[model samples]
Target: MREINNNEYHQWIKETKEIIDKFPERKKSFKTSSKIPVERLYLPSEITNSYLEKLNFPGEYPFTRGIQPTMYRGRLWSMRQYAGFSSAEESNKRYKYLLEQGQTGLSIAFDLPTQIGYDSDDPRAKGEVGKVGVAIDSLKDMEILFDAIPLDKVSTSMTINAPAAILLAMYIVVAEKQGVSADKLSGTIQNDILKEYIARGTYIFPPKPSMRLITDIFKYCSKNMPKWNTISISGYHIREAGSTAVQEIAFTIGNAIAYVESALETGLEIDEFAPRLAFFFNSHNNFFEEIAKFRAARRIWAKVMKERFNAKKKKSLQLRFHTQTAGSTLTAQQPDNNIVRVTLQALAAILGGTQSLHTNSRDEALALPTEESARIALRTQQIIAYESGVTDTVDPLGGSYYIEELTDRIEKEVEKYLQKIDELGGAVKAIEEGYIQREIHKAAYDYQQDIERKQQWIIGLNAFAIENEKMPEIHRVDPIVAQEQEQKLLELKATRDNYAVTSTLKALKEAAKTDKNLMPYIIDAVKVYATLGEITNVLRDVFGEYQPS
Candidate 1:
């Protein structure tokens, strides 16, 4: 193989430009799934030399292709199907079923009440307990969550933001009870409050205190839970909320940077907590673009960690992440069509070299996934790994002229957003000023307009007319689930030592009042069976609620 000289490169660029310019008008109309038109064709000439340097070989400085040299060839991406609903017993059965069906990891989804620091019995939690996910009010619920699964063996991912610290503390306490040392625990917590403000809207305390809680997790995990990922800075919800690919990459990295800043402000070294930081992104229907986005994300993050944050460890600079197929992309009209959509999206994530993945169920557009639908989703990943032969080569699409060009183009576009964010005094300031939210809103509106005008056709929704089709009966949360959960919470309160609970909660309140890390205090309270509401209420009184400006 011979390397092309500058003159040869320029000649290829000139020829490519000519070909692009000669294309017909219809061909020139580049449209995304969101129906946003691309102004011009992206070419190798559009990429800069600096970008090429930044995106080196896989496993090298600035891991553009991937963090691992062999990627899936070494080990297939972990298939982690997110599941949790009703009670802990029900969720545990689901977990065992998933494990038996060949899921490689476990990802726990908590209910809205648990997410916002409320116990199942809280008056505010009425009608919501175990509705969206499992209700874990204390260590008892945590114990039931992992009943037969050995804590030291299975890696778990918990989706909880505002009360992340409390949940993480309970998890640790439970692991200890199971004879698993703190250092042996392996998992991740979605301790990303910034995205909660931007997209998810599950925040409890104000941003300042929230940041402190996040930093406390980082500090605690860095020392105690060595294998634990401190934060899953997520763009999954951002994309689900309808942000463009550029916005997803830009905003997610911006959030990660903000977390780093918060941890550093606590006087922690950059490499200390940075290595444990992981990302979560959405894999939408745009196959090549989604793949390019993940590649660009790794490259951009590696550069940021090394150059901006002065991170010394290779793991600190690497951008390892989990991908979830975009839930927003699923169509409810012909639910079966979603299976095809999910398969394609899952393939894109595998091609993008996600460290782990969760393929959304076809029924997700209507309600929580049924057992059969969840099995199909998990089987999608298994089929891709074993049957498709896509993993036979590392970065099979790596040297494709079109793919490389797209990857470089995406990196440049994300860089532009980063510069704009830097000018606005970082992500916190941008979020405070509502810049991120406004951008996402505009993108969402534009996509909606496309659907309205038929410019972008969702097969079942716009193009293919499926009239009078019998819709599947969607799963609705049982109204009695809340009452059952409430009774259990009340019984626990009656059985536990009320004075011990009060004392532990009082200590937690005192800890919250001071600058001390709340993790230790939280662990203490959880050990005494202090309810989630009591712990969160004390912190609420101290930190107060966040009213977006």
Candidate 2:
């Protein structure tokens, strides 16, 4: 490729301006998150040497374009649709349906009760069991979860934190029951507890103990379950909670660095668990900005792992991520328009070279998606993969002058955030000081104000006025699903060996009090049918709960 010099760039910019000047009546406006005006277009003159070096070839230093030579050509991105609700049986059926419909992998979503380390029968879980997702109280529910699915054949992703270690142990036990060894099973557990304290608000233990749990998983998975992604350092939730694209990238990388530091402190080698480190990002509506964010993230992580941490393995430096279309972008007004929004966001994720993708249902703003809506969302990905010829080439937008410039801009912005976070003593201290949370809140509030003031246009929301129309039926969780899950938990508790349960729980508490690895004790607890609440309560007694400052 021929590189443009300063003279040629200036000439091109002048000619472009001349063409724009010919159309005197024409006007253009650039829109950003906070109603910042954008120029009509960007030229090579707008790009600098710093950006040129940053946007180098894929598989080379600073992988701003992509990480692989073949990318999607070698293998299509993993189509992981997030599903789980009501009961294990119900979720299992849904999984089968998704697999039959050509989903490449499974991503599990747990209910609120399960997320915060409560069993279905716990008093804290009353009226909430199986409300948002499936209720997994013990290994029995996990068994029901993967009853028909072959653990060795398909990869599964679980969205859980706080008690993520316990849940991961239960999953391992279930895989073993299916005759699959730990090494053969592949999947990811969203064990990012730092994000919980920063944005999602599902944390149970304090940050110190939470980091220990995270590090234990890293150590455990590195030795055994090599195929599994120990933790998906997530920025999707952080963005959904209202952070700018720059902040999202910064905070996600910060959290990942914290995990690496913790593992190193535990005496684990950098390359040992680093190869399995994966990321989850949100693909918001800003097409170019979102694309630039993903590209910048890859480049930034590669530099951090290789230069800062001196990681040797190529896999350790490669930043593989899963992208989920932005749910927060969906509007309740003119809900059908969300389909178009999701399609554009999904396309950006594909073009940005995500390893996996999840398209949100259009009706998500209204409620949890109905069966029909979820299928439509899945089909959006299918249509993009098969119908839209965008995936024919790798990093289709790699050489664009505008995209390269934006990628450089995003990288610099994210670096600024990292510096600020480092000054605040890393992610944990930043979270405690309310720096990250307050930044996200300010961004969210500013965006909302712009929408209300008509400075930003959200079709059918702040721009185009519409008359009353019939609304689609929203799906609601059956109230009795909670009762049924609670009864199941009770039955399991009644029939399980009481002595084994008590002894396992006691051992878990003792381990929590000491510096021992919690996974072994957790596995013992799950094997003996100790309920989720029982195990968590033991840890709570030793570690105590975290009250947000």
Candidate 3:
């Protein structure tokens, strides 16, 4: 395609508007999810930068096009559906079901107790075991979770932070039991504790101690697990907590920078660790804006690594991320409509060049998704990859005039936020001083206000709402799951070697006090069937809990 000159660009816009003046526009307000105005028409004149400077070829520097040269042509992005619930046995059933239904990889979601480092039988874990996700108290449960699944064949992603290292250790030990070596294993750990502080409240330890634990994993993985993604710096939770798309990218990139600096300060080189760094983002309802957001994120991150940190490796500069459709957008009212909502969001993610995607189920708003609904969600990605012609091309919408303009716009806005965060002494200090949190709160408040004022419409929410709509039969977990999990934990404790557990905990505590990497100790404890709670409790004893004022 040839570039339109100044005169041609002006004439095209002028001629286009004259035809548009005859027909009345639908609404006076046309904005993206980030509240950026959408012009009636986008002209080439609006894009001042040359294609070489901003829109490089796929797999090139400042990768606005995409990270992979062939992309879906070489291989389609992994259809990794996030599924885990109830006892590990039940969740294992779901995993096997999903794999049989054509899911390419597995994503594990732990219940609140497992996520926060509590055993099933602990007083703090009562009633909550297996309520939100699969409950894995020890290697005993982890074994059941992946019972029939081949660790070497399947790539798993664990959505656990704060206690991510402990869970990763358990996974490694589980793989070893499967006769798969640690270096052959592949997976992602959402070790993004900074976002836990900024938006999500799942944090257990102080930020400083958490950073130490995170860097330790980075150092350990660089030598041990070459195929593993050590940390999935997440923007999904931040957006779910009510942030604009710009804030999502800005804050996520800020957190990534902090992690890189921490690793560098720990004597790990930029190139060695940066290549393994991955990201997680949210795919929301706004279609084109979401696509532009992903493109902008890739471009911005590539520049940040290469220019800001002097990272010479091409893989180190690439921003490979997994995307999950917006859970916050799903509504209990007319839940069936969520399928269409998820399809659009998933499409946006694919168009945005995500490495993997998790589409939210239609029934997710009511409860945990049922087996049938989860199958439907996985099929959505399958249809997009095989049936839809969009995957035939890489960055399919890269050359669109509006998309290009929007990409540049989002990049500039993200840079502005990053600049402000840097001034506030980077992501960690900004989060500590409540700057990031306050900004997200304000954005969320304004979004809610817009809905209340009917300035923005959500189907079945603010507009086209119905009365006495019969609710869909939602999936419900068995009430016995908690008690069953607790009983299992008690039995494991009674059967395991108590002395080996105590000595391992003592060694872990001693290592936590120093600069030693705790992965080996944690793996040893997991090998002896030590519970997740016991291992985390040792760290708590050494580092103490974080009490936010």
Candidate 4:
């Protein structure tokens, strides 16, 4: 970092002020979601480096530019559309559809039951099976979910936490049955339980036990599944839950710090598992700020890994991430307007250098996207990659004065947050004390106040008025899907060797009682078609459950 000469900057500002003072300004101030003020005009003088501190090249140390030298030039960002709903069979059709439409990877969304480790047959599961996303009660459902899609050929991302290991076990067994080796598997699991406790509220065990499960995955995957991304520490949900952009990066990086420290405590070398770590982020409506946030995220994480963790490998420091357009910004009133919102957000993700992206369907704020809407969302990504010329260069907005300044602001703000979290004893303690939650809640409240005061405009939500906007037909899941799922679980239990199922679950419980990694036991249990609830129940009896205040 270099300091700008104030003497030179003052002279430039004085000379420029005379001509600029004659022009009228629109607003008193312009700022980003993180509340950093943007200058009316950015010059090389505003850059602390005096615009001469050697900016590192792309793929170099600190990775301020990008992780890849040939970002989107040799290969475009992977198009992994998030799609899953109804039963595994139904979701499988959707996955094949997306793949045929030139989607490069698969992103699976589990129904609430599976997310919380419930079998479809559990009384607690009731009407929720297959409603929000795909329901996979056992290996049987996972097999149906993948169907003819070869796991070896396609990378998959499963958004499952708390019971992430169980779901991951199911995925591994499915691939094995497809004759794919575990080493051949490539994908990411949202095994990040910290964010769930902070925002999503889908946790199963206490943070201590939950963290143990996460590190166990880290150990197992490091040895067996080398190509796999062990965890996607997420800021996407945090932003959706209404944190400012700075808070999103701050809290997410803080959580990553906790995970790294936990892994080191487990006696695993940093390089042994750091490269497998990844991130998930939101691409919100603020185009330039969103791009700057991504760039800042990479730079911050690189410094943290190198300076704090003492990681040697460049891969260990690189903050590879997937981006999804913000669902929170979508408006049900002007449902059609969401397409434009998604396009801008998706474009920001690309310009900011995401490894992959998921574009939200315009109708998602209303219901599960219909197939037509999903296709339109995919088309948005395709058009951006092919027709939009922005992908021609790496970090096209990298050198812009506004972008660099904004990126530096976000990076500094995030550092202040990290220092605060450090004083409170890391991410878990900050979350347990509700510090992170309170911060996000306060920001969200302030944002709502701005909207109400007409300081912040939300197009159809605030500025535009529509008295009787006709609503489009939204997709509705068949109520019969739950009953069908329940029957399948019952039939599988009755037909399979019950003794084998019981034995594997008992082994899982025994392993849970000890210091052994639990993934193998989970794999064995799911292989015999043991219900998800049964496997989770064994752990629940051992590790107990987590209930936040």
Candidate 5:
């Protein structure tokens, strides 16, 4: 395409106005949530000469268009619905139901006890077992959780942070029982501990030991579980915790740099572990901004890998991510309004070229989604993929003048943030100093002020709310779920070989003391049916817990 001359540019604008004068007059002013003004029409004159270079062909350098050449034309994005609740048997039934309904992948959500490394029978875990998600205490529960599902046939993602390694070990042992080799398994573990310290608050060990555990997984998976994503550096929680799109990617990139530096310090090659690296992000309401955010993130990560890290592999430069619609955007006042919010958010994710996606259910703000709501959520993804024509081309909005300009602006802002983080001695030191937390807090506070002042409207939440809005049916966990899970743990402890459990835990504790990788030892303990709490307790004794100052 050629740029228009100055005379032609002005003539085109005049002709556009003359044509629009025939229509009824109405107000056409609009602006994005980020305050970027909306222009009536875009012309080639508004774009820079180097615009083509920035929006290069898909599957090429920078990857502003997309990581893949064909994008969704070659394959549709995986529809992975995040679901887990009550007992393993109940969650398994939901998984089977979702798969039968055309969901392509599985994402597990662990209960509070499971995520914080406590067994169902623990005194501290009382009244919380299986309330939020599935409660998996040992291999027995893991086996039942994946009962009839073939591990090699589907990809799974586990949302566990502090005790991610133990949960992964249980998954590996589960595959082994199914005659599937570790190399044959493909999945992701949310093993990102940095975000936990910065936002989520699920961290267990202190900074140094936590990095060791993460890097250990990187090393072990690089050799044994080649198909597995060792860690999913997450920006989703940051956005949910109240960050602008720019801060979400910038802070996420800062953390990625820290992980790469740590791995290199351990004598690992950049390409060896970088290719298996994956990311998670949230797709929020701002439609065009969200699309531009994803585009800018890919380009920024590509340059960071090639220029900063000196990465040589093409796969190492690609920014493959899983996107979930923002849970914070769901409104409980008029629950049906959430479905429209999710639809728009899901469309933004699809246009942005996410590798996989999860659409939040309408009733999620109240409780776990019932089977009907969950099915509606999955159908949302299917409708966009099949019924909507947006997926027919790679980066359907790649060349729009507004989208390109927004993408460039977002990249520049994110670079400014990255530079500040570097000046503060990288992500870890900045996090330790509470710099990241303070920034997120300020953004969150400002957003809340906007809602209260009516500067922003959330439809049913602040603007269009009504009285006596009938509630939708919500899924509730049985009160007996905790008691049943606790009984199961007791039976397993009574039946398992206590001597082997003790022997493996002692070896694990000894390994934790030294610099040796703890994955193999952890895997050994998991094989003997050791509980999640018992294994984590051994490490807690050595590494100590993280007490936020």
Candidate 6:
């Protein structure tokens, strides 16, 4: 790679200074734990022209090194622990507890009923309300879930897909009640429905309408909530469902390509909606492989946005993402072993230059994390941020020979997968044809076979011999949580203006039939305190439900 000239170096320093001004670096020594001095970044003694072209400086195009000029130096990645369970009131308390424990952001996990757009009182929602996550039925429930939490103060990521629009509308209405404008909201909604069909099974509508909802979110957020991430095209579920690192990158980018194309087809400018796009990835067991996957993902996304879509803005080309440590890697046999695994995976994510991260709790493999376990998980991030000198530099592992070689290999493999996906007529067609599902199923089955054959070693599982391990206390949702949530919904329905609810539902159903954006209608329905099921039923009537063949 060509050597960076003195003038170029000075220009970069100027930009770095501006970032540091906004987010001052931590006021402490930038040294190793043993007090060994460390540089802000490490570079090779000699440079070649090709190296510079491939791994340009941080914050530059094809952002292989990092996105920001002074990655963690200017500011550390957001520590967002995913939390939610039981009723909205209970989840609200947990959110407060996590914030007090030093979490920088909130990642909400909604229950199955909320995810699929059913009211807590719906017959289909019986016995499942607040089981896996917090159950939200209407604006009343959303208001309770975020009770005292100011939306403008903390970024919140909601893991909702098919019903993302309705939940988002409810959130917006709640913020308005708190005097927080839509423009001030900063967070992401996992609004990518394609992944639900591919790996997860939380999908509601068919692919055509699902794509429409995603692009509508892109369009609405671009015009109103500029700071909000419209859709977090996710590979976390794919990896959890048993995909290789290369498959993770390929499938994610393929889905992203499909989203961008759909938005463009709707007459939306690529740069307008692309800048708000975000990604979600999983950091798995292999230390170096996880880091390489993140770097390779960024480089591939940058090139695709700029070269394929002709994106003009720098933000549009930059691939910002949030990383969560692999839930699949956790072991139920020896739960404490998961802490070590999570630490390794978390470090890899930081080293790979993630903008935000959530480290899984040690007890998550067995159940929802207890308060004590959640604190330990948050402390894991705190220890790494404050003590571990990893945050002192940008892309600490960027120049490692193994990392570089692995990154290149992952990128090439992803390109091959993307080419195949394109040939299969993009992500939507690939899913419709069961091509993507088959690939992930095969990989998952092969992985299981390897573990059974002792070809792969998972500590405390196939390799380690442990007997009668004592179980730690796990968080359990109250059995009466469903009854309480159902009662709350019943009370809401009894008091709310039935006439207004009926009117809004009618308007929403009509809007869903036309090509017009449905965000405004959704917002209107939510404002009238229409339940999630009520709003979704309107859409389900217009757009038939999706059933996997």
* Model 2 lDDT tens row, 1-549: 999888987788899888977765443353465222345567766778576587667777677778888787788899988989889999999999999999989999899999999888778888888877899988999999999899899999999999899999999999889899999999899999999988899999999999999999988999899999999999999999988898899999999988999999999999899999999999998898888889989999999999899999988989999999999899888899999999999999999999999999989898778888889999999999999998888889986877877887888889999999889998889989999999999998988887888767899888885888678899888889888887887799789999999998998898888889889999999999898889999999998999986
lDDT of 5 at 329: 94
* 424-480: candidate 1 lDDT, tens digit per residue: 999989998989999999999988898898877799898886889889977777778
Looking at model 1, the pairs that clash are none
Q: Residue 86 of candidate 5: its Cα lDDT? A: 95
- List where candidate 5 sits over 4 angstroms from the true fold: 1-31, 35-42
In the predicted model 4, the residue pairs found to clash are none
- The residue ranges of model 1 lying beyond 4 angstroms of the native Cα positions read 1-23, 27-30, 34-54
Clashing pairs in 5: none
Minimum summed lDDT over a 10-residue window in model 4 is located at 46-55
TM-score, prediction 4: 0.97
> For model 1, what is the error of residue 320's alpha carbon versus the real structure, in angstroms, after optimal superposition?
0.7
The lowest-lDDT stretch of 10 consecutive residues in candidate 2 is: 28-37
What is the C-alpha lDDT profile of model 6 across 1-549, one tens digit per residue? 999998888677677656657865554533121111223333332223366587999999899999999999999899999999998888999999999999999999999999998888888988888988999988998999999998999999999999999999999999999999999999999999999999999999999999999888888898899899999999999999998888998999999999999999999998888889999999988787888889999999999998999999999999999999999999998899999999999999999999999999999988889999899999999999999999898888777756776677778889999999999989999999999999999989988887887767788998785988788888888889988988887898899999999999998888888998999999998998898999999999999999899
How does candidate 5 fare on TM-score? 0.96
- Cα error, residue 42 of model 1, in Å, equals 7.1
Each model's TM-score? 0.95, 0.96, 0.97, 0.97, 0.96, 0.91
Write model 5 residue lDDT over 1-549, tens digit each, in one string.
Answer: 999889988898778767867766445333246734555566665677798998899999899999999999999988999999999999999999999999999999999999989999999999899988999999999999999999999999999999999999999999999999999999899999999999999898998999999999999999999999999999999999999989999999999999999999999999999999999999999999899999999999999999999999999999999999999999989998899999999999989989999999999999999999999999999999999899888998988988988888889999999999999999999999999999999999988898897777899888988988888777889989999998998899899999999999999999999999999999999999999999999999999999999
Candidate 4 stretches with Cα past 4 Å from truth are 1-13, 21-24, 28-34, 50-54
Model 6 accuracy (lDDT, Cα): 0.90
lDDT of each: 0.89, 0.89, 0.92, 0.91, 0.93, 0.90
Q: Which stretches of candidate 3 lie over 4 Å from their true place?
A: 1-34
